[model samples]
Target: MVVERKEEGKEQLIQRPVYYISEALIESKQRYPHYQKLVYAVLRAQRRLAPYFHEHPIKVVASTPLANIIRNRDATGRIDKWAVELGVHNITYESRHAIKSQALADFLADWEEAQQPSSQADLRHWTLHFDGSKNLEGAGAGVVLTSPKGDVVRYVLQLRFEPCTNNMAEYEALLHGMRIAKEMGATRLRCLGDSDLVASQTSGTCDATDANMIAYKRAVDQAGASFAGHIVE
Candidate 1:
């Protein structure tokens, strides 16, 4: 868990080893059932962080329905004991609504392997390239998509609306390429673009400042989430 607070009119995020713990379960302890194992992990976390938990309120932010599992009347054995022990703490459980920070985003992305297909047969990989060019004439975008079987598909998009910056054009090309790849049933993709700013922004290395850039980032994130695996370069 991470702790953050406002200090001197600035946000401060702190990491203290005293508040963290990691331990491997013993063979007997590890033999618990899946739901009971989850209960044990939560109980262990709270106990290890007891100093901080005793001083401040603790909230569990998770995608799983932890509360429902603990509150069920049929819970027995270790699950029931762990639930009773956890009830003493001033803790609340809340479902995750959205990614609030880069740390949390990384945590979620680390667990996204579960979203991948179970069967690897006929799994397809895709390569994408995006570029925007403008000279004395109008602006246009060039996109290339490569299939796992060495098939190459290319496209050129001509701007029909108002003139846009090179970065905006790059985003447009990337968005367009991703849409086509999704339609073609590509589950894993690697994207390459000449625009460093656009690539870094899309991959969360840099922040998007302007309204247009922010909107583009949202669109790119939404599209990327549809794929089981995605990497932007």
Candidate 2:
């Protein structure tokens, strides 16, 4: 049986920068940059374009739900100005075309939970390793489902284009991973991810929109029904 996760107050946002990104330090301090991921690319893009203050370090804009930004690329393959979102929203993008590292992280967390370990034998203690090597900009999730009954579903997928939004990819990966889980004969399951919002959302603690989640949720529902017994969280 599947139960909805409890709805709590808005949670803090989680951020993870993309891997191997070489960008300016701050105030044009390129040489002395933060070696590891510190500020999110989206936020950085936003600050670079325009600076503003916010109540939360991470802001989840309350838009019309499937809202998006568009920018044209120059000959150098660089975006000029962000289409940008206007007022009247709980979530705000500091970056012009960014979905934010926190949002992506949330989705990953949810995805991981939905795929928890499915067996009790040698396969029960396994874990999925997501390729956060790309940091917040991009990520790849790889899950190997194994059962005492000689079942296996190895899923490895990567998503590119931070401008398109990593949250969308996270959900896409979840749907893909779930489909793979079914293919591998996983009756019982255990999933894992560092993302927190995603885990809660799948549990029904939070609601996601089209760009962040639409097809993925539908797939999840359909798969849940097919199983004599299944769970999502």
lDDT of each: 0.75, 0.43
Candidate 2 lDDT tens digits, 1-233? 01123345636433443222123222222332241122234433343233232332334232322133322223111111222331221343333365434545565577557756554563342233222224554666565655555556576777665644455555556566656666666554444555555555554334567654655555655655444343333
Task: Pick out the ten consecutive residues of candidate 2 with the lowest summed lDDT.
Answer: 73-82
Q: Give the TM-score of each candidate.
A: 0.52, 0.37
Write one digit per residue (lDDT tens) for candidate 1, span 1-233.
Answer: 76655556555763222333333343455577786767666776775577777888887767777889888788886677777878888888778887555664454555555555666632656999989866567778999999887789999999766768778888889999999999988888888888988876775446689999999998987797677667777
Superposition-based RMSD of candidate 1 using all C-alpha atoms, in angstroms: 18.1
**Lowest summed-lDDT stretch of 10 residues in model 1?**
15-24
Error of 1 at 204 (Å): 1.2
**Which candidate leads in lDDT?**
1
In terms of lDDT, model 1 sits at 0.75
Q: Which stretches of candidate 2 lie over 4 Å from their true place?
A: 1-139, 148-153, 160-163
